[model samples]
Target: MSVSFHLCQPGGGASCGACCGLYNFRDHSRAALTRRLTAQTERLSRAPHTPEAYGEAARELTANRDAPALFPIVRVCPLLGFLDAEHQRVGCLGHPRVTGGVDLRDCGVYRATVCESFTCPSFGWLTDAQARLVQAACADWYLYGLVITDVEFVRGCLKLLEWELGGPASPDVLRERPDSLAAVRRLFALKETAPGRDGQATVFGRFAHDTEGEPTPRSLDYAALGTRAAPEDDVVLCLGYTPPDAPALLAARALVRDHVRAVAATFPA
Candidate 1:
């Protein structure tokens, strides 16, 4: 499938640091922290800035330089900090905190580097509207967003969109093919048609259950699939939150089904 990265931007009230945690900071060490800081400083220096601008940036960097030292020896990334009391917004602490807030790409060290190169399954898979729906549903900090672990499912969903719209599925594509929205709405409707009784509802039900307890079966499947991407690949289909109301849930389900069916259609049965 054709993939585009430039469309990547903050959506659904989620930020790049949303994924920051134990996995992102698995190698946090004194040496590693030092190197990370050095790299960030270098990038900042290289940024198009005048002497005064560089000086200001340097001060900001210095202010947050001890970030690694602040956190206890923990598995989670120390840089993961919340922007609000509700913790709905998450981002890097090491990054230069500006007047309004942190711009991960412009200030965050690892985020600017490693995370920038990697496109989470959501970004690569979901249409902008679908992604926003997932984000809005899981806007609260405690509730992790909805994650789609099945790569084939995601691919299938995109295929269905393309088939219906007569073009590659993307955020922009929706404008040209508004009818595609109806298809998405139908998918969500299917989710509510029988609640947990149907297979599709069961999939979403399991996802909800897993969000609160142990990893769901699909979660395991996603992890296994991610490993094939790279040796140390850390990725998953995280939707964050399930839809709150019946209407919203139904719409989200429709989006999910399109992908799931698309994957099933490709099987050599």
Candidate 2:
């Protein structure tokens, strides 16, 4: 169940920059990030190919960054930007493949060696089938990076579907069935379409920043909510829900349950 292919830039309407700290900002919205990446791509495109020029541009971009990093420890690379003229895909702007054989990634925050070798946890954690399903479902750069990087969210959704069906909800099965695949896409789309998740830029799915700005996995306070832990809690938390009261918790739980149920119903009898 290991991924054999590179999950970062599979190039079928799917690409990711999470390892570049794409979603590390306090305002990681699609529109906000598009502007950020677009600006970087445009600015860097105009800079001379020399390391000095690129280095200066990188520093200027970093200094003028609009949003603060959610986790200060994470190094957000300024070289990450749109890979295509249409701005449909994102990747390292300074990569030799991008820069016409000139590897200028060293001018960014990290060295070219580190950038070339680094792999996100999803590379090891996600099964090839699961990775493909994510690629098929969240083909957009923004959604793909967000959903694919969150292992808990993807696993939580499939686990709940299995529970609902009283059997294994195979990633391959979901991918093979168009109806099931669309259902799964809807389930995963909750990452963007989920309600009441606004103003939670500091919360990255199931994680929130500690005082020192390190992402920490969070848990629902069942006692405070006057409720016991439910199966939907994992996905609910991964949906960036910080429920304030019993009703809020219940509502969030219901949202996840409904999506899981939708996926389960798509299965053939």
Which one wins on TM-score? 2
After superposition, candidate 1 runs with Cα above 4 Å error: 1-12, 16-19, 22-75, 98-151, 160-269
Candidate 1 lDDT over residue span 1-269, tens digit each = 33343223244554444344322222333345345534444545344434345445545654654433212221234344444444444444444452224343433334457654655566565555555432333333222222222344334445554555455555333323435344443433332332333223223322332333333533333333232221111111233223334444444445454543543333323
Q: How do the predictions measure up, each by TM-score?
A: 0.33, 0.97
Please write out the lDDT profile of model 2 over residues 168-250, one tens digit for every residue.
98888888889888988888988888888777767989999998888898998888889999899999998899988999888
The residue ranges of model 2 lying beyond 4 angstroms of the native Cα positions read none
Q: What lDDT score goes with residue 7 in model 2?
A: 89
Tally clashing residue pairs in candidate 1.
20
Worst 10 residues of 1 by lDDT: 228-237
Give residue 237's lDDT in candidate 2 (0 to 100).
Answer: 94
Candidate 1's C-alpha lDDT? 0.38
How large is the C-alpha RMSD of every model relative to the true structure? 13.7, 1.2
